[model samples]
Target: MILIEDTVISDDVADKFFVCNLEKCKGACCVEGDLGAPLEASELPVLDEIFPKIKPYLTPEGIKAIEEKGCYEQDWEGDYVTPTIEGRECAYALYDERGVLKCGIEQAYNDGVVDFKKPISCHLYPIRITKYEHYHALNYDRWHICSPACDLGKNLGVPVYKFLKDPLIRAFGDDWYKQLEREIEEK
Candidate 1:
């Protein structure tokens, strides 16, 4: 494990390589999870506030799910998450012409309808964060659906941490990401 400030990061992040192969996986991560994208407490209001802006980009089923279940729901684990369409794709997911799942929230953000991108959890995929009383534990989530990504990453020689630099900085801040880089370099 590598320690940076209050977070303990698993070495797999540096050892493994990954870059989402959306063409191959078709964004299965958005559709195959047991639950919708995880949400932080602070993100609830943001979801509520941005739903209207993102709604236009959603499918009818997605809009219906959100309309009936609200923007988010609490799972059996008592953790908040985005709503799903019939326990399938995330309510915020939209498919492109090729049927690849894309984030409606991200589309809206790119269109300048909202400032917030998708959830930090979704943005930082393959990296799951668990918060303990004293520190946050960061681990790489290995999923078979992402095998193409693993192949691509290895071919390109991009470590998981390096591939995820932008979202890591977004989640942990520039200083924290810089410290993480330094620590990895020293390794």
Candidate 2:
């Protein structure tokens, strides 16, 4: 692990490559996970605030899940996460005519409905974060469903850290990301 500021980042972030192949995976990460996308405590209010704006874009089941279970739910691990539809797709997930999973909150943000673009966890996908009393842990999550993305990323020579620049910046900060890049380059 490489220590940057208060965070310990896994070497896989720089050693492994990954780029989402939406056509191949069909956004399986959003739909196949055992639980909904994890949410930071601070994000609960944002989810609530954007629920109405994204409601129209969600599926009927998703809307009902949100209405009945609230915008977020606590998992067995005691982590707050977005509500899922029948314990499957995320409540905020929508699908296009092609059946590809999409995030309603992100769509709303793109359409200028809200400034927050979904959850930071969703944005920093494949890289799950765990907070500790002293620092945070950043690790890459490998899944069989993402093999196509791994192949594509390898062919394109984009490492996970490089591929997720925007989200890393969103999760940490500009300075932290710059420091990480510098450390990677120095190595």
Candidate 3:
């Protein structure tokens, strides 16, 4: 199985072309929740180690949510959203009275308590990496699920959905962008 990884979608790549009002965006991806990721076989040990620390509040519903692995195409039966375990959102989700996206990961990064320490799955939103043959197709994760912050950044200016949406294309030059997009279409 080939996995698509995002390396170019970060400000490092988008910044080369456009400035981002990340604060303005408010990190809606994290706010939207859906932060729980299934523990891969290799991740089990790490999660097991961390479980005790976080287990007090861990719920069966939260565990079930990861198993569902719902995605953009997953059936969302109306009524606001289909029934989901753990409310199908990130653990750090919150909104101000005005309703804006706020992410704890970025806040932690800004506060210097943590830096680039979030789960890769959490860091890579609106972006993913899928491998094909010997090459990888770096792409954005555009599920159209977000708050006004993401909506504004995506439409008004340059903003990479993920920290590493694609390997800095500059490292590979313009041709890499075309090549990655081509992989997406083919797949």
Q: Which numbered prediction scores highest in lDDT against the true structure? A: 1
Please state the error at residue 106 of candidate 2 in Å.
Answer: 0.6
Task: Point to the candidate with the largest TM-score.
Answer: 1
Candidate 1 per-residue lDDT, tens place, 127-153, comes to: 999999999999999999999999999
- Residue-wise lDDT of candidate 2 within 73-159, one digit each (tens)? 999989999989988999889888888899998888999988999899999988999899999999999989999999999999999
lDDT of 2 at 96: 84
Tens digits of per-residue lDDT for model 3 on 3-25? 23433232222332222334555
Tell me how far candidate 3 lies from the true structure as C-alpha RMSD in angstroms. Answer: 9.5
Provide TM-scores for the models. 0.99, 0.98, 0.42
Judge candidate 1 against the unseen true structure and give its global Cα lDDT, from 0 to 1: 0.95
Off by over 4 Å in 3: 1-42, 56-87, 90-116, 154-156, 161-187
Which consecutive 10 residues in model 2 have the weakest lDDT in total?
Answer: 46-55
Give the TM-score comparing model 1 with the true structure, all chains together. 0.99
